[model samples]
Target: MTSGLDARIRLSRGPVELEVALTAEAGEIIGILGPNGGGKTTTILALAGVLPLEDGHVAVAGGEWEHAGARRLAPEQRSVGLMLADPLLFPHLTALDNVAYGPRSRGSHRTTARERARTELASVGLTEHLGSRPRQLSSGQAARVALARALATDPDLLLLDEPLAALDPETRARTRSDLAARLAPYEGVTVLVTHDPLDALTLADRLVFIEDGRVTQVGTPTEVLREPRTPYVATVVGLNLYAAQSDSSGTLTLVGGARLVTADSTAGSVWATVSPHSVVLHRERPEGSARNAWPMRVSDVTLQGQSARVSLTGPLDLIAEVTLASVASLTVHVGTDLWASVKATEVFTYPR
Candidate 1:
């Protein structure tokens, strides 16, 4: 496959500093997931030529936009389309005119631009609202129009920064589906920046994790879900993560001086991971073959779908996910005493 967008850049502005190397093939969508102030938006701005890189290069469709410290293209000179969290539509223009503006700005004939706009709006399921103004349309409808405007210019790359962040849950779902369908037939590289795990997992071909202005991890969605390298990724993927030191004898020592015996042995510093569901809670110490067990007090309980995630702190701080039925049977509540146990086989240890 041909490369559509390739960038390796470094930028330092006041308190924010970012270094990222990203590459995506034609028709590939790369989702950038991270916490707030993680430089996700800055990376997108650099790609779109809105922010200049202190060093490195950016190339789209084999054409260099910025290279070394000498050559740099203006934002208007790049063949990039950007859709931000806000639709930012022109309040005075109708939806059709707004969609047509991109092509018209590029010197297309007036008739040709309107025809292109009509086609793009239809593709995004906004054909019926073509004459509506920005304020007259619903949030979801405005988002679709914004998407249509972005694609009208036949951009070689698309940058979406939290495109569905403003919509309500139901509207967000419908708009997300529409966005996915509109992107399927596009033969350009796409970069989506979002904090939502569902958006990244469902719409992206690969995922990139950024933390503290640096790229921390990069992999396909399935690969990332199987093994997350950072605490943020672990939390986003709903796994219990602990940083510990492991000896060759399979004893893992946590930062708080708690120890866990694992089936797999490793040396030096390692990261241990276990699913919350794997933790078995008891009202009192129970006789079991499990290698790891500790008396803990329930710290908090949060409902997640049909299960409740119970936070326990005692010998080791951990999260245990149990069904509602189990919560009731165990009388789980904050400040309640309980025993937590996990089999050695369930604890996965890897070198940090």
Candidate 2:
């Protein structure tokens, strides 16, 4: 059967410190994704009992591991499986032997442990490659064997640390698919830490965006993409957003009282966002179709790799993304007069 986890962590070293609270359930994958040095790996390590917490507690499967004042349990006592980036298979051992290593060390009879390892390997489709040594198997096959080895312990909580990071893109994709299929049968709390957004979006039920040692936002895939609370989350969500105020009657005002209508039913304070590609620029304010048009002067034009981003000074400062062909055809240049138009429907409005 699956289980749940409740944790509050505080970790410190030298001048750096971190505090976070997390709750998760079995058969669910909680993806922790962020840029490098964001403390995601540390958080996973702490939960796995590899790193000591300065304060707080961790509980899984109704079994408490630590508490604020007194109680504590050592790492080995916790029924958890942790797999790091490297498979770290013993060079001298075959794939089957490597998987059997964990259970054997835990006191299972050699015959019984090897039987368990064979079952695990067959489940992950690595049974055919059991006799192959780590160096003899392909990278993808090695990854599957590593995953089977982790599962051999029958852990309550599974901790995966960028497990697919070491593979080539093609192998990574296939192995990822294999992993998703295997994890579906596991009825235990699972935590996957990765920097790849594709992996998080595809495999995890919920995504937590962390930075500077704290969680900025956590939500389902769609929720995180639609509503982001911080600038970092905004960038992570692929949005350029700004804080602004709005009055009733569905009319919103920008920083300088530049008025625009909204599709959202909200008032008082709000956030206004428009996609760069949604903006349509013309030589002068033209009528029809588009609802919001503002007088603007080109401030700067930058090529964003293949596409271009043009900055404008107008009723409200805006950035418009256009293709290279459009940049040349519009005769766009710094100081050129243009009218920026964006529909109210395309402008997303949300409470701040």
Candidate 3:
């Protein structure tokens, strides 16, 4: 076996057909992100041997783990560890025992396994809770224990499927930091399947986006942030995206009869995007300098943390994010009429 991963996954379940290509080096983290029922979980399941591939193969570190009908490694036979959204810890067992079980089941001596478990628990900042039962641990602590248990066996590949999906926002943020710290020291390939952009952006070395059983885009976090190829990707990155046809002069006509002026020179079909934070709203048509302005009606106003996302419907339907102070000054509310403006330079266009 070499020191890396290379896999081509193809399978079908009910109405969804999944065909994805994934590759990662040893000790690299790949974040798989997509919408619900978009074959994200299916891809990971195939790698874990829970779902056999109809075609393609799974190879890790120069070892052929699966080759369609030619070969298949059962889940337990493969050196892989899986942690899911639910911790799924044993309710009746102490944290130490729960973690030690992996090493023990794999043939380690009782004392040796317990020692390894102690070290794992301490690495995740759970040394004090070693004797605590699942029922006594908080959601974050239980998740840490589950992660520790997964790492106890020293698998070459680690699979995390929405590992932080079960925690509240604050806990999730803190736990995410802890997870990053723990993963930094592990010398193994990690595949993280998540729907949260923060997790994908902060943790992974690279990102693979799958939608409707197809990879829409793959890039580093910075590259993906600068150029998102699909609407779902745009949504995930918090931008307003549109498919438009552009003329040589840099004017784009959207499919819905709306038009936007951009600074790019790309002609023909292109993807136009605008940051919600770049949009400015006004009570009357008093905008100057901005190249694009339109009369819009507020369809919805949603408060998100310190800012408000205002949905506007006009020549173009758009979401504009503004601070709460601006929300108060504009008195933004449903059915309120307003004018939206955006600078030409703020509009970005790329070949479709």
Q: Which is the leading candidate under lDDT?
A: 3
Q: Per-residue alpha-carbon lDDT of model 3 for 95-121, expressed as tens digits? A: 999999999989999999999999999
Candidate 2 stretches with Cα past 4 Å from truth are 249-261, 275-288, 291-341
Please give the CA lDDT of all the candidate structures.
0.92, 0.84, 0.94
Better of 1 and 2 by TM-score: 1
Our tally of clashes for model 2 stands at 0
Clashing pairs in 2: none
Backbone collisions counted per model: 0, 0, 1
Candidate scoring better on TM-score of 2 and 3: 3
Candidate 1: Cα lDDT at 231: 89
Give a tens-digit lDDT track for model 2, residues 1-352: 1158888889885444768777888788899987777788889888888788889989988888878567777788888887767988888999899999889978899999899999999988987888989999988888888889988988888999999999999999999999999999998888999877778888999988778788878999888778777766665655657677777766887767788877766888887777888888887687988888989999999997788889888778788898888788888989988898988788887888
lDDT of model 2, residue 208: 85
- The numbered model that scores best in TM-score is 3
Off by over 4 Å in 1: 247-249, 265-269
Candidate 1 at 265: error in angstroms? 5.1
**lDDT value for model 3:** 0.94
TM-score of each: 0.93, 0.82, 0.97
RMSD of each: 2.1, 4.1, 1.4
The residue-by-residue lDDT of candidate 1 on 1-352, one tens digit each, is 2368889979985677899999999999999999889899999989988889999899999888998688999999899888988999999999999999999999999899999999999999888998999999999999999999999999999999999999999999999999999999999999999999999999999999999889999999998888889989998888988899998988999988999989987788998999998999998887878999999999999998899999999988899999999999999999999999999999998878
| Superposition error at 322 for model 2 (Å) | 6.3
